[model samples]
Structure formats: C-alpha cells, structure tokens
Target: MSKNIVIIGASRGIGKELVQLFANNEGNHIIALSRNVEAMSEFDHLKNVTYKAFDLSSSTVLEDLTQILSEIKSVDILINNAGKLVNKPFLELTKADIESCYQTNAIGVMLSTQVVVPKMLNKGGHIVNISTMGAFQGSVKFPGLSAYSTSKAGLVSFTELFAEEFKETKIKMNCLCLGAVQTEMLEEAFPGFQAPLSAKSMALYIHDFALNGHKYMNGKILPVSLSTP
Candidate 1:
C-alpha cells in the first residue's frame, strides 16, 4: 500500500533527497518543509509532493502544523532530517550558537515527532532521525562541534526512549548517525574538504532504509561514514 510520509527540513541536503525519492514513488505521498520553500518548489511538479515553509524552532508554528496534520489524517513515515551544525572551537562558540543547534537538531525532532506520531498509532510507521557519527565517538579537536555532537547524542537517546514507548505497537524508531555527506552544509563547514558520500547516494540509502529499515532496526543508531572500512 502507498504510505503517507513527511520529511522535516526538506529544502536541501538529505531531506531534499528523501522528498524526491519518496514522492517519485507512485505509492507514497510526501510533505516537505523548510524555511525557504522556493528552493523546493521545483518539486511541486511531482504529483505526490507538497511543499511548506516552516521553522521547527517556534512552538506556535508547530501548533499550526498540528491542525494541518489532523486534516491529512495520518502518516506512515516520519523523517526528522532538519538540523544545524556549528563547527567552531568550543571556547569560540556563543550561547546563541549552542541554543540554535539544540533547538533545531534536538528539540525540533522531539517536538515534530510528538505532532506526527499519533497519526501512525493504529497503522504503525517508521521514524528516522538524521543524526551524526560524532555523537558516538569524540572528535579530534574539530572544535565548535560540541553543540552539534551533543544535540545528536540527545537525538540518539530520544530514539531509544521513543522506541521503548511504542514497544506494544508496530511503530518503529531509529537514528541515522551520518558521517560526512556532500551537502551544502558540509561544503560550507569544511570549505575545501571533499565528502565521500553524495546527497543522491545518501538519499537512496535512506529511502531503502526507511522502507526495510524498520524490519531489522529499532532504537539503534545506524552509522554511515566514509571513514568506516
């Protein structure tokens, strides 16, 4: 059966790919979100894709989303792919930087799920959070990533907790602890560095993961990294 899926942070990067991949399928319906909806309007040409302008940081904004979602009925998959990263030295980071990271990466995912999960109750579904490998292991003076790492770690923990809550249900939750992927955010952060994985590749992998991932994975962190051999 075709499923209803919503991907947060669908303007670009991994989120964008998820929208494209899922919406392309005749069986799935995709609702994509981001601040710059124009960037994703190209996707509107697809029959199953819907674009919305949204920022996960605002509680009031989510209140509005809840109402909109009620009309959509239910979603079979929820991909929390929206996130922010600040790669400065820990000492160089400011309060705002840390807060923004936590707000987007940690709080955003948690709240967004809260709004979407009820729809999946009777039917069961999958929730995949885009996290970072940095959370699993300490980095080498990469600086400024403390907030990003911490937020992802929190997300990882949340996945476990969420899965436990649904132990009686068919609903499943997991986190994709990504390594360096060739996305605009990566280029902006590293400048000259080359990422081993492309957004297209990551998207394809994630698409498959979302479909079959729930079968083998629940409340576990799946890491995708170029450094892993």
Candidate 2:
C-alpha cells in the first residue's frame, strides 16, 4: 500500500537520499521539509514528492507544521532527521550553543512528533529519530561534541519515554544511533574524517527500517555502524 511519509531535514545528505529512495518507489507519497526548500527544487518534477520550507527550531514550528499536516491529513511515518551540531570544546561552549543544540535536536523532535501522533494514533505509524553514536555512553568520545552529544542524549531519552507512553496506541518509535556517515554535516563537524557509510548507503538501511520497523521494533535504540561501541 502507498504510504504518506514525512521527512524533515530533506535538503541534503541522508534526508535527501531518503527522498530519492522513497520517490523511486512511486507508491509512496513523500513530504520533504527543510529550512531551505530551494535546495530541493530538483525533485519538484517528481509527482510523489512535495517540498516545504520550515525551520525546526523556529518559534512558529508547530503552526507551520500544522498547516502542512492539514493537507496530508494522516502521516504514516515521520523521520526526524533534522539536527544541529556545534563542534566546540566543552569549556568553550556557551549557553547559547547548548540551547540552540537542544532546541533543534531534542525539542524540535518532540514538538513535531506531538503534532503528528494524533493523526497516526488510530491508523498506527512509525517514527524514526536520527541520532548519533556520540549519544552512546560507551562510544569513543570526540573532543568537540559536548553540546551535540548532550542534545542527542536528550532525544534518545525522549524517544524511550515516548514509546512507553504511547505503547498501547501501536505507534512505534525508535532511535537509530548511527555511526559516522559521509555527509556535509560530518565534513563540517570533523573535516577529513572518512566514515565507512555513505549517505546513500545509510539511507537504504533507514528506508527499510522506516517502512517495516513498526512490525517488531518499538522504543529500541538500534545502532547502525561498523565500529565497536
């Protein structure tokens, strides 16, 4: 059956690849959200893909999202791939840095999911939150990810609690603690660090997970990486 899938942060990297992968299926209807929608205009010709410009951290996020959701009516899957990474030493990080990271990575996911849950409550749905291995306690520590990792840890905890709170409703929620992937975000955060997984490759795995994960997975923090962590 065709599904209505909403992908946030769809302008580049994994989110962009996901839009391409889903659009190729033809049966799926995709709504791509990004801060700069113009970057996604290349996909405008595809009938299955619709693009929207919105910032996750904006004060008007809920209002903007509600307007978008109104057109779709129901959402089958929500991919919270939007994130902000501030690469600064712990001592150098400011209050603004931490707040910005939390706002975009943790709070944004909460607000967005809240808006979509009611629509998915009756029909059942899946939510895939994009997280990083940095959030893992045992993972190799990077020097400049204090705010980024802390914010992601908050999201991990939020996903766990949200799953329990809505378990009876059959809305599956999972966090994918991903390893380093070759993307613009990674390059910006760690210049010249080569990750084993490419955005396209990782997107393939995420594609399957988003479509079928609800069948057996809920509240699971699954790691997708080659390194031991």
Candidate 3:
C-alpha cells in the first residue's frame, strides 16, 4: 500500500535525508516542502517524491497550506522537521529573531497542522514534531539558544496537547527532542562542534518511528540523543 507522507524542511539536513529514506521504499509518496525549492532539486529523480515551496514563517502559512492540502487525498504521516536557530546572546536577541523562531518552530507548525488535520481525519495518521534536547526539562542548556530552545519547547507542549485532544480518534502525535546531529543547522548553533550522529543516521530512526511508533505511544515526548542530561 502506498502511503502519503509529508516532510517539511525538506531542503537539507535531516529532512532531506528523511525524504530519501522514505522514498526508497517506492510505495511511499513523499511530499517535500520547504522555503528553499532549489535546494530540493536533488529529489527530482525520485518518481515517488514531489517538492513544493512552503514557508512556515510566512503570515499566510495557513492559507498557503490549506491550498496544498486540498490537492492531496490524505496524509498518512506528517513530519514537522522545520526549525529556525538564532545563536545570539540572550540580551542581544531582536524581536525578529524571536518571532521567526516561534513562527517556524512552533506556531507555524501548529497552523500547518490545522490545515492538514482534515486529510487525516477519516483514516487517521501520525504527526511527529522534531525538537531539540535544549527544550527537554532538566537537560543541559546552551547559552545562546534561549530563543531557539524556547520556541521548540512550544512544540513539545503542542504534541502533548494535540494528542490528548484527539485521543478518541485514530490520529496520534508525539515529539522527539534531538541532541547534536551533524548538519548545517548544528553548525549555525554550535560551530566547530562534531555531533555524535549524522543527519542520515537520525533520519533513519525517524523514518521507522513515523511508520510504527504511533501504535505504542501517543502524546509522548521522547528524547533522541547521545548527550548527557
């Protein structure tokens, strides 16, 4: 059976690898969405994969996504992997920095889900939110990640709340707070730091989880990391 899978932030890093992993199955139709359409050209050869320009930070996120959602028959799985990282000192952060982080990492994800929820309403689906270990309670914190981590924390809350709200239905939601992964995004936040895992390795795990994790858990916030607490 072919499943309709949507992967946001599909231009590079873990999201890009995720598209590759899922598309490898051949039976899965992968919808790759991101603000950078040109960066997604690598997926052009995959017959089962499609790319679109999606800006989560835009004020019209809901409207834009609503239009996209209508063209799809149903979404079997949705991976909210988009994020914004502003590595400014707490005092130096500007309003734009804060807003962009929250909009892309948190609020935008919520509104995007609002548009896609209808597609999953009948047959049900899984929504996996990708967050950061910085947002995990009692975890070690970073000095310049106040805005980034706080915004991701909002996603942590959304996963739990959305799961509880839709418990009676077949829909399920969960959050994964990741540690350091070797990627462009990591370099922006932690320059010269070598993460224990690569984006391809992390995406491998997420690919499997998005398919089966819902059977065992809902509203669960699991930490996927090699970092110490």
Candidate 4:
C-alpha cells in the first residue's frame, strides 16, 4: 500500500534526498513543500511526487497551509525539515534574526503540525522534527548558533510535549537532533568545517525512522551523529 508522506523544505539537502528516496519506492506518495517550487523541477518526472510552493515564515502560512491540506485526505508521515540558520555572534544578532529563526524553525513547525494532526486522527501518523545536536543539553555548543540552537531546542521540547499529549492517540512525534551534515546550511554556518555524514546518508536513516519509528519510539529526541558533537 502506498503511504502518504508530506515533507516540508523539500527543495534541497536532506529534504530533497528524502523525496527522491521515498518517490523511488513504488508504495509511497510524496508531497513536497518548499518556498521555491522551481527548485523541485528535478522531481517532476517522478509520478509519486508532488511539489508545492510555500513559505513557512510567511505571516499567512497557516491560511496557505490550510488550503494545501484541504487537497489531501490524509497524511501518514509529516517531516518538518524546514529551518533557518543565522551565523552571527550573539552580541551581533538582531531582533529580526532571532525572530526569523524562531518563526521558521519552531513556530512554523508547530502550526504545520497542528493543521496536519486532524488529518491523521483516524488513520494514525508519525511526525519527525529535524533538529540539531546543539539543542541537546550536554552536547558541544557551537558559536554563532545562538538563535538557531535556541529555536531548535524549543522544537525539541515541543516534540516531547506533543508526543506525550497524544500518547493514547494513534499519532506519534519525535525529534531527530542531527549532527553536522555536508549541506549548504552547514557550510554557511561553519565554513570549512567538514561533517562526517552526507545529506543523503542522513535522509536514508530519517526515511526509515519516519516509516517505522512509531513502532517502538515515541516522545524521544534521538541524536543522529558520528561524533560526540
């Protein structure tokens, strides 16, 4: 049976790889959302993939998302992979910078989930929130990631709370606190710093996790990384 999977920020990096991985499978239907719809043209040939233009940080995101949600009867899996990263010293960070990071990483994710949960109420579903290792309490902290880390930490908390709130229900939520991966966001955040894992590799794990994670894991913040950080 083909499962309906929705992935936000699917135009690049791990999100794009995830779309390709799932779309290649015969029994999966992928709905990809990104701000730049044109960037997803590469996947247009895939019969199972559908792309939507959406800006999570926009003020009308909820309204725009509701319209998109109306077209899909149900969602089996929802991956919140959209995030914003601003590399600036804490003292140099502006109010807009922090707000932008939180709006995209935390608030947008929450709103999207809220709209999708009802669709999964009867059929059951899973949510995978992409976070960062920096959000972990004891994890090694990186400079210039104050806003990003803090916003992701908020998401980590929301995942736990959401899972617990829906414990008796068929819906499950978990946060994947990822370590550095070789992506544009990583290079921009820490230039020249090489990450051991590639975006494709991480996407594979996330794909499996999204499909089977609810079986044994719920309300967990699983860290994906090769090193301590």
Candidate 5:
C-alpha cells in the first residue's frame, strides 16, 4: 500500500531526513515543502519525492497551499516539521521576532493542517507536529528561547484541541517535543553543544510514529529526547 506523505520544512535537518527515510521504501509518495527549494535538490533522484517552495511565514500561505495541493487527491500523513528559532534575550526580542516565531511555528502549522485535514477525513490520517522541549511544561527552560519556546508551546496546545474536535472522525493529531538533536538548526541555536541524537536518528523515530502511532494515541504530546531537560 503506497502512502501519500506531506512533510513540512523538508529542506534540511530532521525534516529532510524524514523525507529521505520515507522515500527509501519507494512505496510512499512524498511532498517536501520548505522555503529552500534548492536545498532539497539532493532528492531529485528519488522519483517518489517532490519539492515545493513553501514559506510558512509568508502572508500568502493559504494561497500557496491551495496551488500546491491542487492535484493531490488524498494525504495519508502530514508532518509539521518546519520551525523558526529566534534566540535572543527576553527584552532583546522584538515584536517581529515574536510574530515570526508564532507565525511559522504555530499559526502556519495550524493553517497548513487545516487544508490537509479534508483530504484525510475519509480514510483517516496522522498529523505529527514537531515541537521543542523548550515548549514542554516542566522541562528546563532556556533563557534566549523565549520567542521560539513560547510559540512552540502553542503547537502543543493545538494538538490537544484539534484532537478533541476531531475525536469522532478518523484524523488523529499529536505533537512531539524534542530535546537537543545534531542538525544545522541545533548548531545555529547552540554554537558548541553536542547533541546525542543525529537528525537521521531522531527522524527514524518520527517516521515510525507518523506511520503507526495514530493506532495507539491521539492528541498526545510525547517527548522524544536522549537526555533529560
């Protein structure tokens, strides 16, 4: 059975690895969405994969998604993996910084999922939101991630709300709060921090979860990390 999977923020890091991992099976059709179309050119050889220029922060996200999803009849899985990390002191963070974080990490994900939900309503589908440990309650909070963390917390909230709203339906939504993982984004956020999990390793877990997790859970916020807080 071939699955139609849509991966947001698929140009790099964990998102890119997820696309690659899913594509390896050759039975899944993948739509890789990200702002960086060039970065995903590495996947041109994979016939099952397609890349689209997607910007979650753009003012035209809805319009953009309309055009992108025009031809797709159904989607089995949607991975909201795109994120914007703004690391700055509490006072140093400007309105634009905070807005950008929320727009991309929260609003964009919700809006994007809004359109895809229709496609999955009939057959049932899984929507996995990629969040951060900084957003998780009780997790050790970092100082400079005020904007990033808060916005991500919104994603966690959305998961529970969305699940309840669609409980009678087959669509299941969940969020994963991730700790440190070695990726370009991680390096940029923490200059010299050594993360125990590689992007591929973390994506491996997410990949499986996206495929079969809905059978066991819905609207759950699970933490996927190698270390505590």
Candidate 6:
C-alpha cells in the first residue's frame, strides 16, 4: 500500500536523503518540513511530495500542522530529524544555546510527533527520531560537545518514554543515533571533522531502516557509524 510519510527537518542532511529515497518509491507520499523550503528545491521536480516551511519552535506549530494536515488523510511514518547543536565549552555555552538545542532536538521532536502519531493509530506507524552517536558513549572529553550530547541523550530518553506510552497501539518508535556525516551541520559543528558516511550513504541507510528496521526495532537506540570494525 502507498504510505504517507512525514519528515521533519527535511531541508538537509539525513532528512534530505530520506526525501530523495522515499520519493524514488511510487507508493510513498512525502511531506517534507523545514524552516526553509528553498533548501529542498532539488526535489521540486518530484511528484507525490509536498513541502512546508515553519519554525518548529514557534507557538504556531500546532495551528500550522492542523492546516497542512487537514488536507491529508493520514501518515504512516513520522521522522523527527530536525535538530540544532552547539559545540562550545560548558562555561562558554550561553543559556540561549542550551535552551535552543533542547527545544529543537528534544522538545520540538516530542511536540511534532504528538501531532502525527494519533493520525497513525488506526493503521500502525513508525516514528524514527534522529539522534547522535555521541549520546551512546560518554563524550565529556570530545571538546565543546556538551550541549550537543546532552540534547541527544534527552532525545534517546524521550524516545524510550514515548514508546512506553503507546503500548496499546501498533505504532512503534526508535532512535537513529547517527554518527559523523558529511552535512552542513557536521561542518558547522566540527569545522573539519571528517566523516566516513557521506550524505548519500546515510540516505541509503535511512531507506533500508524505514523499510525493514521498524519491524523488530522499537524502544531502542540504533547507531549508524562509519567504522568497519
């Protein structure tokens, strides 16, 4: 059956790859949401795909969602990949930066999923939260990664908690703790940090995950890294 998929933070990175991957499949209807729709212009030529640009932090998220969703009947999958991270020393990190990270990475994901999960209840759905591998092992010494790691950690927790809340539903939840990827976010966060996974490879992983990972993967944090060992 054709599936309606909602992808938040779809302008770039893993989200962008998902837009491309899902678009390749004829049965998928994709809704790509980001703060700037222009970033997704590459997919403009594709059919069965729609775009929405809005600040997830804005108070109008619910209202904006209602308007957009009123036109669509349902979504079979929700990918919360929108996130912000600031790499700075604990002392140098500003209150605004910390709060912004939490809001975007953790709170924004929670609120956005809340808007979509109910629509999926009648027909079991999958919710994939894009997190970071930094949350897996302690990164206190990873240089200026305090805020980033913490927010991802919070996201992992949120995924576990939310999964428990839906015990009665066929819907499932999982966290994709992605490792370094060649994305603007990586460049901006690590400047010159080299990654083993290219955006294309990352996108492929997302496609496979959505197609098969959700079947036996719920309430778990899955890591995607470059190392072969």
lDDT top scorer: 5
Task: Tell me the lDDT of candidate 2.
Answer: 0.91
Q: Per-residue lDDT of 1-229 in model 5, one digit per residue for the tens?
A: 7899999999999999999999988899999999989999999999999899999999888889978999999999999999999989999999999999999999999889988999998899999999999989999888899999999999999999999999999999999999999999989988999999999999999999999999999999998877756
Model 4 RMSD to the real structure?
0.9
Query: How would you encode candidate 4's per-residue C-alpha lDDT over 61-143 as one tens digit per residue?
Result: 88988998788899999999998999899999999999999999999999999889999999999999999998988999978
TM-score per candidate: 0.95, 0.97, 0.98, 0.98, 0.99, 0.94
Query: Clash number for every model?
Result: 2, 0, 0, 0, 0, 0
Q: Encode model 2's per-residue lDDT on 83-192: one tens digit a residue.
A: 89999989999999999999899998899998999889889999999998999768887889989998999889988999999988979999999998999999998899
Ranking by lDDT: 5, 3, 4, 2, 1, 6
Residue 223 of model 2, lDDT score: 76
Off by over 4 Å in 2: none
Worst 10 residues of 2 by lDDT: 220-229
Clashing pairs in 2: none
Residue 190 of model 6, lDDT score: 77
Candidate 6 C-alpha lDDT tens digits along 116-186:
87798898888888888888765323768788788889989988998899977888888988878888998
Candidate 1, 1-229: lDDT as tens digits: 7999988889988888889889877878888888898899889688888788878777665685686576688889998898888888888889999998999899877888888888999898999998888876553335568988898889999999999988899899999888889999998888988888899999999999998899898998887877543
Candidate 5 weakest ten by summed lDDT: 220-229
Task: Give the Å error, residue 63, model 4.
Answer: 0.9
Better of 1 and 5 by lDDT: 5
> Which lDDT tens digits does candidate 3 get at residues 42-129?
9999999989999999989999987776679899999999999999999999999999999999999999999888899999999999
In model 4, which regions exceed 4 Å deviation?
none
Report, for every candidate in turn, its global Cα lDDT versus the true structure. Answer: 0.86, 0.91, 0.94, 0.93, 0.94, 0.83
